[model samples]
Target chain A: MKSDIILAGVGGQGILSIATALGEAALADNLLIKQAETHGMSQRGGAVYSHMRISDRPISSDLIPGGAADLILSVEPMESLRYLPYLSETGYLVTNITPFVNIPNYPDIEKVMEEIRKLPRFIAIDADAIAKEVGSSRASNMVMLGAASPFIDIEFSKIEAGIRTIFGRKGEEVVNLNLEALRRGRQFAEENR
Target chain B: MQKHLFLGVEAIGQGAIDGGMSGVYSYPGTPSTEITEFIQENPLAEERNIHRTWTANEKTALETALGMSYAGKRAMSCMKHVGLNVAADVFVNAAMTGVNGGLIVTVADDPSMHSSQNEQDSRFYGKFAMVPVLEPSSQQEAYDMARDGFALSEQTKVPVMLRITTRLAHSRAGVARKEVLPENQLSLPADPRQFILLPAIARRKYKGLLESQNLFLKLSEESIYNRYEEGAEKSLGIIACGIAYNYLMEHYPNGTCPYPVVKISQYPLPENYINRLDQECDEILVLEEGAPMVEEMLKGFFAKGTPIKGRLDGTLPRDGELNPDLIAKALGKQMFSGYAIPEVVANRPPALCMGCGHQDAYVAMNEVLADYSKGRVFSDIGCYTLGALPPYETIFSCVDMGASITMAKGAADAGLIPAVAMIGDSTFAHSGITGLLDAVNEKSSITVVISDNESISMTGGQDSSAFGKIESICIGLGVDPAHIHTIVPLKKNHEEMVRLFREEFAYNGVSVIIPRRECIQRASSRKRNKK
Candidate 1:
């Protein structure tokens, strides 16, 4: 009845969009949700993460305790490994294979992937490529969310409806493309499993 | 009523709207920006014609809100913790002057210095000003306290402070709504000389404030926000304040704690419950965000009789922030050691955008200053403050708002010739004017680079107060017209920009070089919206 997720990415990468979609789904399911987000200077290009907790009962802390996160859903590979200290032993790390190369000392992508693969449970996807294939490269965050969807406590239908609600202003074409991207991401995760 | 998700800032804004706020005044700052933004965007607020607009700075915002309150209307002024320092002059005096209608001065503290220069607790300001401070532990309370805070102010004839930390301000949760109230009609203070702080009147008002301390304590004692919950164990009593209360609860999931607890959201320490906990329990653990204000009061200078623990005693780390894991460790519970992150994940500090004028401006400044030794550039708070970061670490000082020019002037006075001051346009408008005026009065030999990005940029591109007026502002401040130069900060104009800096540096008097360009983020977004 409870899910704790750490949504990670570079600032302005639209990780908040994925968090909002899940929040909307949690609301539809009548679950108590608390999401702690980073704002201001960090959004200029720093590494950022949102600690999201959803439960059938009231949640206490806005922050999830370290090692209690059931999922580390990251849109960037290196950013995903940054939050390993918060991931539970059985937690699933769903991250994009792409690297957000804003920092000068960003390590080799292969080593980054190797560290991620060391985790007992993880799903790495080229969410950017899948998003482009589904139309709209910006929807990669949605694809990252979809890859983590199976582990989320909320139903997939609720997430779909949530996306419709969130992207309603962007027009039907954008929403349809995002839904298709979500499906493709979910399919990839399912096939890999 | 249907429940809706809202960030703590948005919830406070919504609550203020429903609570009959006549005006909400602010200058945008991180975590605190969205409060005024929410009100400005709300249909209800617009329909009510509430005075919601970006102010020149936090001081102006506080004064404007006070003016609204003087006319007997409910008003709220908001700013980040450091912004409170900017408005401290009026803020302290307002407590002595008291109120005519209702006023809520909300200050959002940034622990961990998320987007600020320090992690100062605003509660200290409340204590210094001797006003009641309401610290909400939850988003719902963030709404409720803001809604009820106005009434508390009206009843006490003093402004009330609703303090929130970055986590609570930026976090999202479900907040219930209240019925809308009507704004107060125009009514001046009962006393004709209530607000007049002449030497004789100031003494009387200060005395009144000192006497009112008892009533303030009484209000805290009876406040619904402060509670005493009894537990079977008396070995360790916990006093959890503000958001720290939630972190304590995270450890005890069954809605019960083994230790007796006092949950404090209202200030003045709720002495009665503290006494009860002290009498019943052998020791006390004081859990509070920011500085160990409560813990210090309880511990006192002598180290006291009963053992009290917190930041000072290292029960909690003296700095940064508190999370649930730290709370668990404090309770002697076995802590979880999650997997360590590999060194591959390097630190990704915040930087100026790719096309940001600040970046190009720094590039040109760096090139121009290559001949001179480093540690000559002083900068203020803004995106340009990032010039202190790598690839273009050009700035030498990142102090308070507007300190750049004044500090540079001081350095020039100390024989550091060709001194440079870097500041953003919004920051220049905020407090940079007076400093520039000071430099001009003395004709100090310092070069001031007003990096005009045409937006606040730091706190998400709020409209700059001196958008198109920077040149005139400098002229009016007595800078020579010939010495005030403007350059477009782009790669194509790098040489021109460098030449401008060189000219200003050699001027032997107060000079300004305004590197003007619209913020790339706002520019691109505007283009997208136009399409």
Candidate 2:
């Protein structure tokens, strides 16, 4: 009945969309939710994170303390590793394999994936490729959300409904594309994990 | 009752609206910008014709809000902690003048300097001004306090400060809306000379302000926001202030901390609860979000009192935001840290966006300045301040808003010929105009580069007050028309921009080079909206 999720990614990568969808699902289920987001200067291509906590009980802190996150759901490969310390011993580290190589010192992609692979409970998926395969390349965050959905306590249908509700204003076409991306990502995690 | 998810800032905005606020004024800054933004977008505000718009800066915003309050309408002026510094003159004086209608000065402090230059606690400002300061521990409190803050202000006839740190300001939670109140009708203060703070009047007002401290304290003592929770354990008394209470409660999921807790959201320190805790417990641990104001007060100058532990005593680190883990550690709980980040994960500092005009502006400025000494470019706050980062580390200084021009003028005056002042359009509108005037009045030898991105660009592309008028403002400011050059900031115009920079740098007087373009983020969002 509780999930402490760390949504990690570079600024402008739409990690907040994932949080919004999850928050929608949590609310629809009549659960208490708290989300702390990074704003201002950090949003200018900086490493940004949102600490999202959902529980049946009243959530106290907006932040998920280090080593308490149920899921570290990240849109980028190295970005996922940035929040490794926040992951609980039993938590899942779900991240896209796509490396957002904005910085010059971005470590080797293979090496970064090697570290992710070292985790006992982790799912590394090519969310970008799957998102592109589904419809829009912009829906990679949704795909990552899908990959991490299994670890989240919320029902899958609620997450889908959440996406639909969030993207409803964008019209059905955009909604379906994102839903498809989500499904494809879930499928990838199911088979791989 | 229906519940809606709201960021702390959004909750305040909604609460203000529901509390019959007639106007909300602010200059956009991180964590605080969204408060004004929420009001600006609210349908009720639009229908009610509430005054919601970006001001030139925080000072103007507070002054205008004060003016609105003079007309006996509920008004709110919000700004980040640093913005309070700009508005301090009016803020401190407003206490002496008091208010006709309820006035709430909401200040969001940035602890850990998330997007700020300093981690100044605004609660100190509240204490300095001798006003009722409300710091909400939860979004619900934020909503309730903001909704009722006006009433408290009116009852006491002093501006109430609702202070929040970045965590609470940016965090989100479900907030139920309260019954909407009607705005106060237009009426003047009964005392015609109440606001006139002449020396003769000021002395009486100052005494009244001092005398009213007891009422403020009584209100704090009786405040619904402040609560005393008894615990069996008296070894440690914890004074958790504002959002720090949340971190303390996070440790005890069942909402039962062994130590007696004095949850203080309303300040004047609420001495009654603290006195009980002080007398009851063996030692006190002052848990607060920003600086150890409460902690210092408890310990006194000599630290001879109760064993007070906090940032001052090194029980908590001196700086940075507090987390549950830090609180747990202070409580003698086993720390929980998973794996350390792999050394390969690189630090990704914030940088100018891919198509940011600041990049081209900095590029041309760097190219031109490569010929001169490196430490010549003085910059102001905005997206252009990112130029101090890698690739084009052209800016030597990034101080407060509008310090660039004046600093450059000072450097130029000191014989650093052709000193460069790099600033942004929004900042140029904020305080840069005054500095430019100062430079002009002296005809100081400085090349001022106004990177006009047509928007604030920082804090999420808020509309700049100087939009479409940077050129005209410069011309009006008495900068020679021939000396002011505007160029498109693009690779194609790189040569031209460099040429203009070179020309202005050699002018030996106040000259301006404006690189005009729309912020790419704003441009892209505009296109998206168009679509």
lDDT of 2 at B49: 98
lDDT of 1: 0.92
lDDT of model 1, residue A57: 88
Worst 10 residues of 2 chain A by lDDT: A97-106
Query: Which residue pairs in candidate 2 collide?
Result: none
Residues B1-531 of candidate 1: C-alpha lDDT, one tens digit per residue: 688699999999998998899999898887799999999999999999998989999999998888888889999999999999999999999998998889999999998998989999999999999999999999999999888899999988899999999999999999889888887888887798998999899999999999988999999999999999989999999999999999999988898998999999998779999999999999999999999999888886777678998888887899999999888888988867678989878999999888888888898888889989889999999988888878898998998999999999999999999899999999999999999999999999999999998998888778988989999999998999999989888899999988888777888999999889999998988898799
* Worst 10 contiguous positions by lDDT, candidate 2 chain B: B296-305
lDDT for every model?
0.92, 0.92
Going through the candidates in order, what fraction of the true interface contacts does each contain? 0.90, 0.91
Error of 1 at B229 (Å): 0.8
Candidate 1 regions exceeding 4 Å error are none
Q: Which regions of candidate 2 are displaced past 4 Å?
A: none
DockQ for all models, in order?
0.89, 0.88
Query: Would candidate 1 be rated incorrect, acceptable, medium or high by CAPRI criteria?
Result: high
Clashing pairs in 1: none
